[model samples]
Target: MNRFRPVRTMVAAGTVLAAAGTAHSAWNSTALRTPPPDPPPVTEYVSLLMPVRNEAGRVGPALRSLLAQEHLPRAEVIVLDDQSTDDTGDVVRRLCGPYRHARVVRGTAPKPGSPGKAHACHQLASLARGSVLVFVDADVVLASHAVASSVALLRSTGLDLVSPFPRQAAEGPANRLVQPLLQWSWLTALPLRRAEASPRPALSAANGQFLVVDATALYGCGGFAAVTDEVLEDMALIRALKRAGGQGGIVDGSRIARCRMYDGWRDLREGYGKSLWTAFGSGGGAAAVCALLVWAYVVPPLAALRGSRWGAAGYVAAVTGRTLTARRTGGRCWPDALAHPVSVGLLVALTARSWLGHRRSTLTWKGRPLRGWH
Candidate 1:
């Protein structure tokens, strides 16, 4: 019974442990919100660009949202179509045909072994006319003043790069657990406000979904050329910007941008699969850490239920802590919290598969293989 006690207790402990983890995470949850403060007004030209690859359904709404924005009515929008099999090119053409500032340009894949996004963005940057260059993923939708608000921040702070933390729209059972968990993890890892308050070049939070870069500084800092091979382009870009004596931070995209990320769980899985392993880096060490994290929450609850009240209590404490932390970070619906165990499991499995795919360089996104994943 004693041997089995810990096992049983682990089950009970999982809940408590998760709670505790959430609690610790709450302290750093401000990364999700855009503080009410606005950047001082300054004269800065901005151009918005979107690089699309077979994003027909989502592109229209995304573009429409931008056209409707009250800020930067003159901000030119350029969509770089990346050889899509779908009517992505047609959609971009039709959606913005009436707007003179809105334009669509075609993009080609980089030569074998060269990174695709950096290459494409390099081309887009060349044609871009704004003093401030912005890259919004095709899936990203902008708020009426998102461009205005963001540019204001950059000008006011004199920062080199700006990225928004998006408010994701997720549906179905699978999205409920995994997406929120993923966001929570981000909230836990980076404390943006504190980073901004410090002087030692801390706090690295970004979402490629809505990345804004200063055109001149980008060139001065070696541009995307510096991070040509990085799988996590957003983070790499931010790091490069900082290394080049620039500042990077996240802003409230709620007023500036919105992203659904994927149409379904499979889409989410494949998308994350292509980049997750790379996000954590080579070897299977990332897998080990992920598994351990999931088990940390899963085990405690089981133990608590089995009779080792102490273990069970500890786990419950942990889980409660995690829950509180999540609420502070940005609340997910209650059902997602209930389904966290399964969500965590799916994430681990997906991450493991991603790592395998990365090792073999077999990961693909939107029908394009991510070259040099390993």
Candidate 2:
């Protein structure tokens, strides 16, 4: 009887987490709200910044979306081809030629100890002349009102910066298992209301794909230069801004922007492996999170297959939580939710690989080594 004690304990813990995750998902659904419609004829001018590298075939839709903005005259688009080996520069130049305000600039190499993306962003800021600076990733497609609404949200709330985390579009096997977990991690764990209200750096969240900030505030916090070495530059910038006494927080932008972050299994794996270990702060924190996930998400399904009724209920609750999160974030949930354990397992594996790669100096992205991944 004592030999089964650990299994019984795991079953009980799984039940508790499933209940908590379900409740947390429910709370997030109620708390997350869409940004208000953009005021007509938005007077505030915005510099839309793009940093690209080897995005030849995939960046066209994003460029098209930016050029077709309904609030165009108030927006100036700037593209920095960060020393691409492909035709990314040509794609940008050809697509943006008709827009009088659009300009493409050649990006220089990063200074020592600085991440390439952060350096590219800092260079873009030097060329921008707008009061509002919008940093957009090359893979994101913004809605017609995305810029206008983001600016309006900032103006109305009196915040210095706002990160409108776009809806993640995941396809293929790996993506279907892993992408939805991005939004779920914060939505269920961070308590959005508190994060929004708190100015603490640890509570802040930001997505690089669609970050909107007041130009003055960004410069005030030293722009991306403040987080030059950070692998997660987006979230680091938010933290730096908050520590600099500027108020900023995340908002639900599922209605305004969509991003397909990686192409397939290999891309997705390395994409995550480049930063997952550092995401939770330290080795200890990463270990704790991984253990928790294994217990909360992975174990129940295994026990269920072994004919444990309570474990089956826990699996149902976990799936319900994922479904609720997907409903809110505009992701696929049906089959993916059923594979929640698989997703968590993949995340754990990626995180372990990330730490190992960092130790071995093998972690890289777009030909740049992630030196600060430790």
Candidate 3:
């Protein structure tokens, strides 16, 4: 055990160094992503398309934020409130009725067996009128510059799609301890900047909470109806964009948008379980999440608990690595990374739940029962 300590420290340090370097690429390309393309010759029409189910509580604030965007355009806010049983209709009616650009289309029932959101988004897209269409979830509140930020990137880069990794708002013990996974998974696992940089469109990953698209491109590629059955429409859309040789990437969503992803631990567990299964899939789900936890969080802390100077130094570096990354990215809860063991344990539980969900085939979400795609 003593002999192996140095080797473990070196390997862990290398991992930290690697992640730090890879994540740093976003900062390098920031200026390029904000190119000065003289604000298009015309107003260049854009519409904000929001698809909601029972998000009455969240939709009001989200709509307000969308309306407040700075220099956005002659934009229209189209909220496709998917036939909710809640006060969703009244909520949209009050917020959208007064404003000319803000309008709500009450969604018709999905074809007997279709998922609610996919069908709702399809309806939203069909009704929207703009050169550029943005699909923002009702729960996500955009920062004043979010629309401009994504549009600028799209204009500068000429990509068919632009997805923002949402800024997740959380409180309480469970929320604080586990939210970093949402940020780090994309940063460490994917070569995100490289994907966005290249025009080849082979690289992929998109956050549906806030996704922007060229209207012609969206329809030319078959539209939201194309992914009406996908359990993870965001990732599915990313794949579709790639197969059609379109561009996709993540940005500093925290600066321009935020979302209370869940009410509490139970919602987080179930919601993420469903999402994790879609994102990570079954066979790789359990083992891969476990390995990441062990490597990134568990093992380093274990070395620190040994109560030796070298162990302390290694663990301190681990914490520093995570903290620095979090500080720069604005997407993760850095303090939560300190709750390594508990978070990893819960993550494993969720991973297990996801596997069980896939098998049982009753992984319901937002009032729709899930179907096993893989």
lDDT leader = 2
Q: Tell me the tens digit of each residue's lDDT in model 1 across 1-374.
A: 68965665555455555555565566555444452334443356678888888888878888887766554644788888987899999998999899888888999777675447877777788888889998888777777667777777766677777776666777766666677665566555556665543334335656778887789888887777677687677777776676777777676565456678877878888888877786654455676668566766555545555666655565555545446544653446564565555666777888888887876888777676777644
In candidate 3, stretches whose alpha carbon ends up further than 4 angstroms from where it belongs are 1-42, 111-115, 197-202, 307-314, 331-334, 372-374
Residue range 270-298, candidate 2, lDDT tens digits = 88888886798899999998998888888
Give me the overall lDDT of model 3. Answer: 0.70
TM-score top scorer: 2
Better of 1 and 2 by lDDT: 2
Off by over 4 Å in 1: 1-20, 30-42, 113-115, 194-203, 308-331
lDDT of 3 at 353: 83
The lDDT per prediction is: 0.69, 0.86, 0.70
Question: Model 2, 133: alpha-carbon shift in Å?
Answer: 0.9
Per-model TM values vs. the true structure: 0.85, 0.95, 0.85
**Model 1 compared with the native: what TM-score?**
0.85
Clashes of 1: 45
lDDT of 3 by residue, 121-216 (tens): 888889988898889988899877778777877776777787867767777777766776566556555566677645443356778899888887
